[model samples]
Target: MPTMTAAQRRDLAKQEFDAFLADCPSRLVLDRISDKWVTLVIASLADGPLRFSELSRQLAGVSQKMLTQTLRTLERDGLVTRTVTASVPVRVDYALTDLGVSLQDTVRHLKTWAESHVPQVREAQEAYDRRAGQEVGA
Candidate 1:
């Protein structure tokens, strides 16, 4: 049997930490779009830009506060563009940038993967809950 010295253990830990940090995608694109809501917002903009109200209506169950925060983050990341129009009143529209457009394929691939695994994942969840003696809910 082999044992690790203190120096060896510290080196290994530092190496693992560095690897983890290196593997993490930069905050530029992923920081905001990593969340489901932000990803969906970007996907919705694929067809075309949408007004704030339009987006709110399309994304059901999303509170106005969350939508606003998501939009702001997306804009900061340059994944979404915001424009203001002065008509009879004022209007705001959001559209995806070229960078954001590139994310569509990645998101689509993820969707496909999840859809394929839905049954397996649900069964696993049920099994885990049963093992834990948790109710499946009414």
Candidate 2:
């Protein structure tokens, strides 16, 4: 048997990569990218790199442990890079990779949609609650 080249290996991997499959590796990638922290972190880094403290401040409500975990996951997935600076306090920065940047526009659109549709969503929820109440009475 002949050993496959790098290109051949990549082709084979791509051929077998299917997100719809329960055990497919691509499904894990999808799960990671779909996480709320992942979305926020990626979107926050869209402009440029930010230190851990800065990111925590910008994200508002993210705990330090959660941020650290999300960053580690992003780094593991090759979506973000972590850099350490030789400063007085030793600053660590996180920045999106090219692959991460490719997702920025889509994430931004999702963010925008959520923000703009809140009122409509609230109205829908109220209507749903009223209907549920009527059904309970009936």
- Name the lDDT value of residue 129 in candidate 1: 85
Which structure among the candidates has the greatest TM-score? 2
Prediction 1 global C-alpha lDDT: 0.82
Q: Write the per-residue lDDT of candidate 1 for residues 26-70, one digit (tens) a residue.
A: 544455556889877877788989999999999998999999999
Q: Could you list the CA RMSD of all candidates, in the order they appear?
A: 7.5, 4.6
For model 2, residues 1-138, the per-residue Cα lDDT tens digits are: 899999999977876787766778888888888899999999899899999989999999999999999999999988999999899989898999999999999999988898999999999999999999999999
Among these predicted structures, which one has the highest lDDT? 2
Shift of residue 38 alpha carbon in model 1, Å? 0.8
Tell me the deviation in Å of residue 72 in model 2.
0.5
Query: Per-prediction TM-score, please?
Result: 0.73, 0.83
TM-score of candidate 2 relative to the true fold: 0.83
